[model samples]
Target: MIKNMKWLLLVSLTFVACNNDDSDTPAEVPVVAGSAVFTKYIALGDSFAAGYSDGALFAKGQSNSYANILSQQFAAAGGGAFTTPLMLDNIGGFSSGGLQVPKFPTRLTFIGATSSPANVPGVSATPITTHLTGTFSNLGVPGAKSFHLIAPGYGNLAGVFATPATANPYFARFASSATTSVLADAVAQTPTFFSLFIGGNDVLGYATNGGVPTSQDPVLGDDITPTATFNFAYNTLVTTLTANGAKGVVANLPYITTLPHFTTVPYNPLTAKSIGKNNDAVGLATIKLLNAQLYGPLKQALTALGAGDRINLLSETSTSPLLIKDETLPNLGAQLAAIFAPTLGAQTAGAYGAIFGQARQAKTTDLILLTTKDAIGTAPTAANSGLGIAPAFPLNAFGISFPLQDKHVLIPTEIAEIKTATDAYNVIIAAAAEAKGLAFVDTRSVLAQLSNGGFRFGNFTMTSSYAVGGAFSLDGVHPSARGYGLIANIFIDAINAKYGSTLRHVDLALYPIQYPLTIQ
Candidate 1:
């Protein structure tokens, strides 16, 4: 009986070993057959995907984005040419060390223009001018919102680069007001593979507004992409792409506040010391509270201020008062002075305006704030200075930026809020990508790392410091072409890893910055 029991135990062990061996046997996992399944690639998204920046949409920036770069690799592997909204012309090249970039039109502000609207050319038209030849593959649109992709006949809509009514001579030669947009065109194309990068511009408009509570000011209009809307549009877009038998990649939004434009101009809280009032003058806090109303949650706080606090709020934007020009803030500081003066008396108001002007003119400690830091540079004094106002930095010169305008202090709360919103947006992006089986590229972290020092990309060092051969543009918000390339690589690596594609990596050495050769 003992002998039979030992034999039974040995047989049971042998059976278990055999089962383990079978489980360990290599299974025939299917490889993605025919790279051509991904051959007919279509790209859809906003400016980052389109590589729009530096005030002009151009081929160089457009071609360098990861989508285009990936498409190039796909084509080399027998894919098709990527179709994009290539800028028609007047794209200014990079500045030294890539620190200063000339805005579109070189001189005109987004707010200020001449009596006659300047003619600006548009992207290519269909057939002869457009991408209908079936040779085209990329479909990137600048200023495109997530839902805009599906909007009826959006491509043919005017006011993108030019308006048809203006008979805008500039666009007459190049505008394709009749051409189909990325959404309609890509859907019509029926690509086997696609890339979707939309919804960035949605939140961007609000962040640019300084994070004011849209709930209180309906006129302010909610600038962020409503979460529900984003979900609906994004789901529909993805469903359509997948249902069409196309496999594609999607990217999340980049942090808005990280750009050089936002970072370079900081508002220092301490400089509030330079501004104060006595029994004769209104308190500086009133000026501050009022100015803060134009942005952020401070408007609620301003409403609570007493009439005795009637002194004009010194704006952190211009270091003067908030002014409205026909309901819109004008490009000039004089406009703010005119509208914001307390009804003390004509003399007092004039005196206030003069003092406001002095603050506007003050370089040592007068603070200026704007709906955008971009406006700060255009302040009359800095415009006349020949040398633009230096961006404010933290006193420690470490990474933390303390907002300042010509040494004057500005509030830190709104800026901090902007950064917080950016972080939150990026987090949403990351979570969404993970849930949807997509790759999330943390551009904020990547940029911060580079700016804090620099990052290594295939032996190349990419820094974020302005014009220091770093990756940022002059506005400090947008990246240099090289910077964009770095961005492309970040997305590319993520896509490659998630999808198992061995696409060629970006060649950073080929792209060079044009501004501040050294940070010091």
Candidate 2:
């Protein structure tokens, strides 16, 4: 009770910084539009533009998206109304195609000091089957890649039921036509000024899935779009948007590998408290047992195979890194089986060799994905069941007794792959912005700064830390409402710098660090 109370107090203190000035009277500030016109503003991009936070997009999240915030500021400088395809309720996610899982799940909420954000506890009311009328100024669709913007039938309702499900559920709800593309719908609006912050989802999908290969994306739209594919798609969209003399601001993609989704879960999380769940004695005993039965034999076998440094003895007083499967590592299973077969039977020995052959303790360069944190100490039966992978002695603790699978962690090689792709993507974005003469917002460097240390907003500094950090929501991927406000200011800064406009910055302090347990 005391801990929850303290966290609640801290939450209040962290979000709302006291200015000490209670005066109601406000000072009038002068503003100017300079050379840019804001009469029909349109926002086009992915989830960030639509204001997705806490793992889902809800009513309040859309209201506070950077696009909407920027639109409101644009309104002050002669911009028109910025309408959004608002969801039906505060709880996000929606029922689509009668899928059992309801397509997307409900939005996440923080209740005091929980280990992770919990669902808001209800079914999402927005149904993809039901269509929303009206031409909205905000044409941002979640889960959209660069190529998806120009791909026709991206909004087709029938595509949602196709074998691969070609259409996006978010777009299927509000698309102007069954065959209209996201860019086509935006082009129809004919905006005088616009904002495009896309191409992150191209890399985001693969990065979030722990560098899953582009070919096998179990999660649809989770594959990394090829560099050439992204280059052509981005250029095409920019060219079409600017073809009609529409001036806009374009934000570049960030290195998503540094986001909280990839960084929050430390490589070494096996501490005394975590291992035993607040019991030091039991944890020490378990550690001893694991060392004697697992580590000792495994280390001996690996060292004999010229890989002694792969496994290390656990220290009772220190933290231990989890054993993870690195696909890039050379398989030593056959060699390991021969060595372990002396004491253990051939079948059991072979199982151990097969599981740990390419496995090693996670290093600093390796990233333990945020979603994989909870599955650390649990048994891996449900996933690996019937695969003939389990050892004979019930040594099935994930990341402890058994190595975590490829989906659970991103090794150095995978990290390099994502970074390389992001670097190439950024070059294309910068080149497009220059060639088109559009205002450019370097979101890559901005997010990098946020990850390295923290981003300063007045007296408070917001880090990208999960759950508690003001910059990111519980999901660890999308930014919080306050983070979106900071992003809005970033766009305004670029717009002002490029076009000599004097757009007013939104008050970052006014935005909440995160939505409360219930938005309604």
Tell how far residue 476 is off in model 2, in angstroms: 0.2
Q: How many backbone clashes does candidate 1 have?
A: 39
TM-score of 1: 0.57
Local distance difference test values of all predictions, in order: 0.48, 0.85
Worst 10 residues of 2 by lDDT: 385-394
Of candidate 1, the 10-residue stretch with the lowest lDDT total is 393-402
Candidate 1 structure quality by residue, lDDT tens digits, 174-231:
2233444445566677887777777666665555544433531111233565666666
RMSD of 2: 10.3
